[model samples]
Target: MNESIAIAWPTDDELRAVGETKVLFGHQSVGADILDGVARVYAGASVAAPVIADVSSGEDAPDGTLMHACLGVNGEPLSKFAAFAEMLDTPVAEGVDVALMKLCYVDITASTDVQAVFDAYTSMMADLEAAHPDVRFLYTTVPLTADRGWKSKVRALLGGDDRMGPADNVARERYNTMVREKYAASGRLVDIAAVESAGTDERSQDGHTYHVLNQSLTLDRGHLNEAGSEAVAAELLKTVATYSPVA
Candidate 1:
């Protein structure tokens, strides 16, 4: 993981000239804010392009995740859709150490077919890892179910329409469990979902028990409250600190 892999980043003006780059930035208080908070907590570590992929499909587009997206490297422009391969081809970049990035939460609950999601992610990860030996991608778990009304719970229990409920939580934990089983020791994952559910409650649905978000940690279903963001940010910092380059 060379600290000096300088990417050919573009200036703010250059980015403005292109239409594609405009859409990814300017989220007032969402994913990027949390990562920014994490960077602030770890004195020596920093987060760059704390943004989500502007591209719509996670499975097909390199821009589907922030790590895969072509981001404004240190507020300067690089190629619009430069993925990890592009980063590895050039000299070391300044904004982010291309060696590692947490693949931001992809909503597994959105897909009942968790195996397919994992298969796609695994396929993407394997290629990236194979091509860029210097790079390590960190996987993260989905946030706990924050939309747990009894009606929704019942709906989820039935396995029909509820996206966030007891069964959904079970899915979250199941996938997260697999992640830990596969990646924890190697430092390929940072379990932000664990922090999000710290001291959370457990409820049963159709003989399955799963975790729910502590109300303190959520603004609503699938959204983080201020405390929630802070907790996640700190945990992310802890993970970054472990593998961060020594100053």
Candidate 2:
């Protein structure tokens, strides 16, 4: 939340000069307000949502600005990334300048080899950068969470998610560390993990990563509460303004 010390944010004049940059934010429930937050933090100079109907993520692509159709018209997430990608192939997103592919909860709790996962992620980013040479492809960090206790089991019943426990937290940290060190590690990436900590949770070795405080998360043990969401939103604006700008 401290913008002054943030390593790479753009000057207000530069951000304003860039005008309204269209950004496609591929995310889950926690990211719902990110665009709106960008509007609030940047005020008149904002990162606007892209034209979704024209994007093409996959073969079953919809015809129009269908990115908004991923969840139907009801605001639910339907195969989120797949749909987002599918729509990007369409014509509506031709002018999109930036894309944030939000990693899923499964990536954090799947209990997989962190290195292998990060390697695959790096490859994916490379591919994206190759495919969309003009658009800025930013790597995003997943938020840290406390042990969900019985809530983990509840998530399993609803769908499938690994329990948010010591081992899972370790994996999450490992992945995030790789993201920071291997990726730009600066303003080019959206450091969701670095910003959500409220100084109330346990810290990682670097001191920037912290588990989500109970106050910052809903009972699900992973999703961001209003305060957490707002904090993240502010950081996201800084990240975009600092790195992905109008050319």
Candidate 3:
């Protein structure tokens, strides 16, 4: 990480705005990491953080809370969409100012059909938006995995991009590109991938340059460490505060 470049933390007014917003987020472990960062952010600042709750379908969080749940099984991308749409159908989604679901890195593999995943996501989000016209649906890109080091670099040189690490990231990049193309102008995007890959040198192999999770940001292959978590969570809060919900 560059020590000279400063991260843009949420302003006091933005923090207050998000505090009053009722958000429903469906995600897996990385999402938990982000929520951890959210807590750290509020703790260090002079604002009261919103309530964070873990609830299931048919359960509703109190007003001014950020209600969240782990949705779908890993390796099953479509299931996440199904689970989130189902949640939107229940009372849990009532009066929600913002709602989104994030697909874990495990959800997309080298063999996964990125187009199919994108199609499912777009169709489901469209249905949910029509059903809950009052709620603003934020679209999130899938999280990314760190490059697998020497072996991954060699594979990139050999044009063997069919394995799990870099190839899977390629699939994820394709999906994220599609998402950005579709919703780039909508002002409802929370681009987790961009945050994960930022502030680091781009990795290149076989004359192709690509983005990967900044190794300094993770102790493991995919999950975020404290600093990484805080970086991503700050962007998330800042983005969430930009929306003015329909009155």
**Candidate achieving the largest TM-score:** 3
Report residue 215 deviation for candidate 1 (angstroms). Answer: 1.1
Q: What ranges in model 2 sit over 4 Å off?
A: 1-19, 33-87, 147-162, 201-214, 217-219
Q: Which regions in candidate 3 have their CA more than 4 angstroms from the true location?
A: 1-5, 150-164, 205-208, 244-247
Candidate 1 all-Cα RMSD: 12.1
What's the alpha carbon RMSD for model 3? 3.2
Q: For model 3, what is the C-alpha lDDT against the true structure?
A: 0.83
Give the 10-residue window scoring lowest on summed lDDT in candidate 1.
Answer: 1-10
What is the per-residue lDDT of model 2 for residues 94-161, given as tens digits with 9 covering 90 to 100? 66666666664445653566676577667666776788888776678766665555766677678654
Please list the residue runs of candidate 1 whose C-alpha ends up more than 4 Å from where it truly belongs after superposition.
1-30, 39-106, 150-162
For residues 201-246, could you state the per-residue lDDT of candidate 1 as single tens digits?
A: 5666677666666666666655666566666766554444344332
In candidate 3, what are the lDDT values of residues 1-247, reduced to their tens digit?
A: 3221245799888888899889999999999999999999999899999999887645778877889988989889888899999888888888889888899888877789889999999999999889888888899888888878787668867986634476677778888889999987898898988888876666655554656787767768589888878888898888778873522
Write down the lDDT that model 1 would get. 0.47
* Best of the two (2, 3) by lDDT: 3
Question: Which residue pairs in candidate 1 collide?
Answer: 4-92, 5-91, 5-92, 5-93, 6-91, 6-92, 6-93, 7-93, 9-77, 10-77
Strongest candidate by lDDT: 3
Question: Using Cα atoms with residue i matched to residue i, what is each candidate's TM-score against the true structure?
Answer: 0.60, 0.66, 0.90
Clashes of 2: 21
